[model samples]
Target: MSASPKYSVELIDGPSRVQFTSASSILRPDGYHPAGAPHLISSATAEVYGNPKATKTIRIGNGGLGPTGALRQLCLAFLGERPDLRIDWVVNHSRHTQVALQAGSIDVALTYEREEEQAAETEGWSRTMGILCHDHFIIAGPRQDPAGLRGLHGSVGRANDVEVSKVKPLSTVAFANIARSQSTFHSRGDGSATMHRELGIWDSAGVPPREQGWYKVIAGTPLAALQRAAADVAYLLIDRATFLYAHHIGAVRDVEVFVEGGSELMNTTCILVRTEERRGAVLEFVEWLQGTEAQAIIERFGKNWELGVPLVTPVSQLEVAPHGKRS
Candidate 1:
């Protein structure tokens, strides 16, 4: 008869998580222990503490705003102190960002669509941290001004002189004229936050661009749409930052700012945290972004460079309502 064999097996649980692999050894007929055959481990258990410092990457989705570049620069500067930290930026339109956030593909999103933000909050998928900055949308077109928006600008200037409400009425009239004249208007058409704003303006004006030959939908980024507009000598509704960036980069020379400085044209970028798992880092980043140091960086963004003008106004200087509440 073979001699009985004795062996020991143990599992230790420590404060930190640990994984274990199983190995089986056979006792030889001569009472000699043989090396275990190499086999795959069937199962293992690991404990995770969910430490923020242990996180490898902080995923961020940007909605293609000009200020996003400054935000990325600030993030890199902040990460320099913590060599262990990293950032993964997913630059997309605001609508796509919302989808990614809801799908848990990204941890946070920076977007300019207030309605989408409110919907996410209502759906309990995310919450807005705060307003990062405010930028105004401007109508740009060929220097010839085919739509004759100068008259509208003059009217707005006169209204400002008298402290009367100018943005809504003038904007309505401008859209009416665009529709009336059938002037070519290039739309982002990419379901971006900017596109959402454009739709709102059209809706308020009671003139939908649907089936309108003069309204062209360019399904691309804001910059791409702007380039197409410039090439076609068409009018385009673009954010101030993107227009200035294009000018700075010499991407478009023919398009000029036709109409600006309206409350309805206000573009508010809001920060949102997708989940609670990375809430610690996200909250810290948000607090830092809203602080004086970060605000100062935002205030100086795109200034003294080739643009010669700041792309976005900091939240501090702009009076903005919190997300879900618009003034």
Candidate 2:
């Protein structure tokens, strides 16, 4: 039948061009292809090319458990405002994100790991653009409050005794009590921002090295670690956003916010941009995040009927420097 009159078809859509032949099919360079189709021989690969003046793609590395979602929303809004730009988000915890930013794999990073930020600045690999938002860390535990941390909530603001004033904050004192009582305590131990804060609290409390039986370290995300804490009735240090989100979604029911509020528990999320060719766009995005419109979105995030409270406060509401330093 003379190969049924062999025909060639070329389809050009957006930034990709696909060619199909009667004898064979080829994969497209856009990384997409029709499913449930047999692979064919006679390879004639498709070619994909962007227009000479097409929009640029900005890659962002994010390392926060709760703020990641809100940042993605802000990115969508920015993209809408600037059609000439697109975004590719690399979501990982603070450690991995910091590594990626240092390795030149990402253009900008939204991170909460203070050590990583300091190290990057010292190494001259990245510089802080501004503070994105802030959320307080809260100690969550079973409603029964085995460590009696609920009572310490009142002491969050006052230091009645000189020894208490010299000691760590009330939240850290709660951790100290938990350690002394041999009550179960869950630690993320995954180099996340939350873990960083938790470690500081433990250090300030002068708690000994984590014991294996009572102190459990889960090398996982905050949400997963919180779930483990709930299952085991252990105490946990978590950002307000993650706790509230989990509570709203029914991921956390037995746990209650035991201790919160204080300068020690203030968590600031910062924007760090790599020193690279796309510095201008990265800086623009960072500046936009602190603007009125972006701040509005951040202030309202996680404030739906299910949660009834916002995850983070806008940076404008606080006295944070443009470079994310305390003013």
Candidate 3:
């Protein structure tokens, strides 16, 4: 830690509820911290009146829910004390940071999007370089199904592919292809980067726009839209972190994650490093992440493995995508 602390940079995809608790445990007193994501958009106008040159490092922890978790709070505190400094922050998804890092664009990334490229760092790409966190997916739906999710539930349609509804131990929403319902399926709106990933899954499944009938695009955070789903019993997709918090607060509960304990299921976060400067301060940060302290924070923070959702392989394994990008 530099005593001068003169630079400010945004950290993307962090500061979850658990991360906040863990952050409070280790952050040094008198340090500056700032928390702001689109969820905490109010923080954006907090004012940066301090000397830009005086700050050594302005760290931004990326997390979508709100000014959540400890890392972001600490960063806000640091910035509050000294607003003047060179600051660069990118509070987006992990994939964004991963691309930036590999492309040599960012200094560091606190992300959940697993980078397949990092497979080179390990043998056979089996061991990905990342600090794992708890994450999972859930499907939301209407209590009654006009699209036939209820009828299709646990009922297999394909034979050679030998698909069975499987009637998952936990029930979320029925998985339907794009060809099935255009107006039936729902997700975040067009600008939402995450929606791109959802769209890709449909693409991978060979679900086409023509296949969809009742699909609708709603603009809002996962939790917000999830709430809407609950009210209307409309179907929606959600990440585990958001699901946990939402479920905890009773923001939404009827929906559940149908997929669990399979080769395809995974939930984890990672620290991304720009390929260009994989040395010095940047490397130190990456190494620090892998170290006991950083890993401890991530391990103990927002994501909960005890909930029984294991952090498995990289996102590359899933139809997970960025900007509707395909693998």
Q: Could you estimate the TM-score for every candidate?
A: 0.74, 0.74, 0.54
- How much does each candidate deviate from the true structure in C-alpha RMSD? 18.6, 15.0, 13.8
**Of the pair 2 and 3, which is ahead by lDDT?**
2
Q: Write the per-residue lDDT of candidate 3 for residues 1-327, one digit (tens) a residue.
A: 734222223323334221111111111121112333211121121222235465354333244423233343323433454444423454444433343343233455555544343542331212234653444554546555444544544554331243424453222124442234433566675333355445545544444432344666676667677787677656666665565556555566556443333323344555544334434544544565555554444334443523432122222334222221000
- Once superposed on the true structure, which residue ranges of model 3 sit more than 4 Å away at CA? 1-54, 58-89, 98-106, 112-129, 132-134, 142-155, 158-173, 177-183, 189-193, 209-211, 278-282, 302-327
> Candidate 3: how many backbone clashes?
51
Rank order by lDDT, top first? Answer: 2, 1, 3
Q: 185-262, model 2: which lDDT tens digit per residue?
A: 888765567776787777676664354478887766677788889889889898877787677777777788877777
Worst 10 residues of 1 by lDDT: 39-48
Compared with the true structure, all predictions reach lDDT values of 0.64, 0.65, 0.42
Model 1 deviation from native, Cα RMSD in Å: 18.6
Find the 10 residues in a row with the least total lDDT in model 3.
18-27
> What lDDT score is found at residue 223 in candidate 1?
81
The TM-score that candidate 3 achieves is 0.54
The alpha-carbon lDDT assigned to residue 115 of candidate 3 equals 34
